[model samples]
Target chain A: MGEFRMPSLGADMAAGTLVAWRKQPGDVVHRGDIIAEVETDKGVIEVEVFDEGVVETLLVAVNAKVPVGTPLASIASAGSIAAVPSAPSPVQAPPPAAARVHATPLARTVAKALGVDVTKVHGTGDGGVIVRADVDRAAAEVTSTPRPDRMRQAIAAAMTRSKREIPHFYLAHTVDLGPALTWLSARNEARSVTDRVLPGALFVRAVARAARAVPELNAHWTGESAPPLPYVHVGVAVALRGGGLVAPAIHDTDTLDVDGVMRAMADLVDRARGLKLTATEMGEATITVTSLGDRGVEVNVPVIVPPQVAIVGFGKVVDRPWVVAGVVVPRPVVTISLAADHRVTDGHRAGRFLASVVAFLEDPEKP
Target chain B: MKREDIEAVVIQKLAKAAPGTDPGSLDRDEAYRDALDLDSMDFLRFVDALHEALGVDVPEAHYPKILTIRACTAYLEAVLAKR
Candidate 1:
């Protein structure tokens, strides 16, 4: 592409505002054809197109303020359409996202949040893999959310490091589980509902269901090294029923079901209450789920917990007024937070994952 | 370093800095653009490498004066003399 900058039509012209662009973006123009009109310091001047081809980009618009030499329009070469030139390529790059099989959850979040497109962000770690620090550094370059609370502080440190060093982004869903919970309750009542399906277990089950649908969400960040293991570990944050919070996760939540999540949630909550959590439980988690609001959150951006590239928060389930078919009805609402590393996942992918989570929560009767 | 040695090092280092094309057979008389077919980035890379190699501070004000190969030789000689 060739840049057509605002020129000093006369010696009197030091700067000129763009009065209008006669040719819009992608409009074809031949050499010497006037592409735009500029109001010069002396008079209105017609800026001519230099090369022939389609107008690839117009940096300034009609009534737009501009300076001399400020690139106003760009034309493609002979028969060449000016595509947004990919930012000058950084030396070595990553392979495609589809080819990426196993990365740590934390690494994935870090990558997605950073908008680095994990598939393209070449991994320097062992086995051609991308790591936590890569995502951390990338996140730091973007949104630097500083220290606030203990979990928030730990999360900030982890994310700051993730953004600074790693890359990540997330998709999310504000789910409403009143209907699903009602269904579970109805089934329980019909069968003399003994175990009151803990809301956290339900939330975990919802996570498992959605993850199974999108295996990409169930992935782990494979560290900086290449040739690494390619599976996702599921992290579940448990608010100790008595005091404090215990978020020991159920590794590989994608492979498990509601029943498995129930057992794991029970075990973790028990251990967490007694302060019996281990280092592996704390450090090795690829994803973290905090059910501060029980089923989901009101609104949240869960911090990516270091090596784990994704952290999802489930807020409290509340009964509120809702609209359905133009009628006001008392219904339940749930919100979830999907704070991820922006480097790998775009907002669109993260939005889809969140939608999947919402879809699973809305009508969860499954095989 | 001799003037020829300095110029050779600058050209060689510039080629590796951007990772693609090299400083195409430059000489004291050749214009920088005509010699290497360089764009702005290539020139910037050359300046950065030159600064790194010689451990001297050069600023943007020197760009217009030292853009050509002959001009670069003159600028380096003057800087070396001053140091």
Candidate 2:
């Protein structure tokens, strides 16, 4: 018998949601066959089986959130759980009459530590046996302490690693927006109140264009100093309820149309504010931009997301004075600050990126 | 295509599609935002126009290439040339 456990994709991931099962029990599985879809912060990824085996028992159900090293299923040629290393998670323990209820190697170790009757705790693990969590939970209940859930631990590790390792360089530029404000006011007046164009939508478009102009800023930076990616997968930061943060990438904002971008932004914002994002959507961000303009943070130096080379911070749009062809004029200007990875991009490139972003914002209609 | 010609075409198209942008006197190869005021909305509009003008789809896989006016123009040109 062999144990099929969930492998940890990264240091940040503790548990993964089994989105779907590609393979079923009793069907023979070969190595490299896509067995399941696991949701991690990076998005939905196909999980492949490593060894060829006969599926003996299905240990976990689809859509279940199972921890790393958990036995997703078990494979065997005959009635045996003794051959596998261990089974480490709970499942719907099978009928007792079908198989011998023996504790797995790890389960026996955990059972010895907990002193719980492994047979009595109910072997929900593969082949009707106790696993690590059953023993730990049984032990915890008696001890009166619950472990921190998998989500919390994963989030902590990702954020901590991002903060410590990435060296960030900050660049800020104030947009001169006399013409842009003029254009916006006229455009709003021309359209019905119900159909007025979105300034927020316009800003998103601007960032997309700016990144395109300074293409180098669009990719994620490898911490070990590898070259950045050529394409830009833009991440939009949205504040969730209860005051936490999650930045979900819009896939390719640089390539989407205004309407498409508007819809995507709205959908992602709604999800980031709620619970709609899959682990895959949350995980793979090439670059991210934040909008705290609603919250009134004028200038923010956000930390560079690991693997991502830069993050743009958007702040409040307020009226300010500016020069137009040597004439002083008033305008509704906003501050755009870019936090870039110093290791991959220089100040010259960063400045150009910010400048391009400012230009895009000032005239989003420009093709 | 010469860099200048590509930049001019980008400026002309952007002005027609979204207006109120100044395609400054900087070198044509200068980045779009550095030489002109075409924010994200303008950028999106530009992409839409590029698709319409080039008769080429900016499929999900090709989106990352729409970075600069020259780059965008070159992509459009390549897609059109291939067609």
Candidate 3:
């Protein structure tokens, strides 16, 4: 039998609460099947099972909080004699509702005072247990805010650790978007409104291509050494409508064209805002790209998210005076900035990476 | 469709585009992009939602004319009237 453990969804994630289980004992599970939903500081992530087997036992109960590496379930290998038939005979029917409801003492007191059913109020606390605030929110019937405070705390913890541990070197290059815009306009004019690609897609594709050319930039910083990832999974930083942000990976980004990037981005953004991202999408970023699209910010100096060695930032594209062939002329321009870990790469390598990005953006037609 | 109906459709699409945001809180005259912190992709999605709901294809050139709730309603009104 193999154990399915609670996955570390990010460098910052320490523990996650088991919100719900998609599979019960005796259910056949595939290698990539989402077995459970885990709630972390980032949000509720759909956790996938890497082992294809029949679930023998669910070690963790729904709403139980477990640390990274804790075994959540056991699975019998596929075709094994222990693999029960499709009809699920749960080894353990989830503990009775009375016994399953985990809540803090304060929460119980508050729920009693407010005449709220403690069992009915979903817990946002550790291990899916109810806390005092949850009781109060239930009492007041406020459902609009979805734990933005916990998300903010998560961001704070990650960013704080990043700034403290990672010695970052920053570089910026201004790329003329005149060529790109003209190319995009011509390409978009022929397409329907829904099919048209945005400049942001071009930016992501350029970053992916540049990362492929300069592989070192697409790597993770283990304390001992920096290793380049085999594939470029470029994480796009998406701001949540509920007040935080998540940088989920667009898997194998280097293989996608601009239109593919656009479609991927649209789907990713929709799922991200819905808080339905998978565990791999949450954790496996080789590099990240962030943009302040059309908000008029000319540049941004980003901080590297730990484990990932580099992050690329793009500012708003605007009109600027350009010197073309020794003559000054108006041109659309955007500033691309890179924040890389100094421990892994130097300014020279960082500069070359930025140059590659510039080259790709300047000649967008090149596959 | 009536102008009010167009406005309701715009609000519904906006809510769909930026899921967690409150459509009722949006200022009719204020730019939806700025108010909702919507990036270019989100705005495109809002436009796409409008297209799906109303069968109105908003061209790229006319994006600026529909940045606000009031503006979007008026633009859709003009387009639907012509249709």
Model 2: residues with Cα > 4 Å off, grouped in runs: A1-11, A17-156, A181-197, B1-83
Best model number under lDDT = 3
lDDT per residue for candidate 1 within A260-287, as digits (tens), equals 6766766665454434443334434555
Clashing pairs in 3: A65-A127
- When candidate 3 is compared with the true two-chain complex, its DockQ is 0.71
Q: Write the per-residue lDDT of candidate 2 for residues A1-367, one digit (tens) a residue.
A: 7777876654467787665566666667777676766756443455677767766666876556779989987776444323533334345644454234455545543443334545556667777566777777776566544322334455577668877876778999888665665666676555433233556766677777777787777765544664656555677776543234567777777788665776787667645433445333566566788877655567767777666778888787887787878998877788888888777778999998888888777666787
DockQ of each: 0.01, 0.02, 0.71
- Each prediction's TM-score versus the true structure: 0.42, 0.54, 0.87
Stretches of candidate 1 off by over 4 Å are A1-172, A190-194, A222-230, A239-246, A278-280, A294-297, B1-83
Clash totals in order:
96, 28, 1
> Per-residue lDDT for B7-55 in model 2, tens only?
5666677665333345544444566653454444445556556556545
lDDT of 3 by residue, B1-83 (tens): 99999999999888877665777687899888878777888788888889888999988889889989999999999999997
lDDT of 3 by residue, A205-258 (tens): 999998999999899888887888899999999987647899999999999999
Residue-level lDDT for A179 in candidate 3: 95
Q: What is the lDDT for A230 in model 3?
A: 90
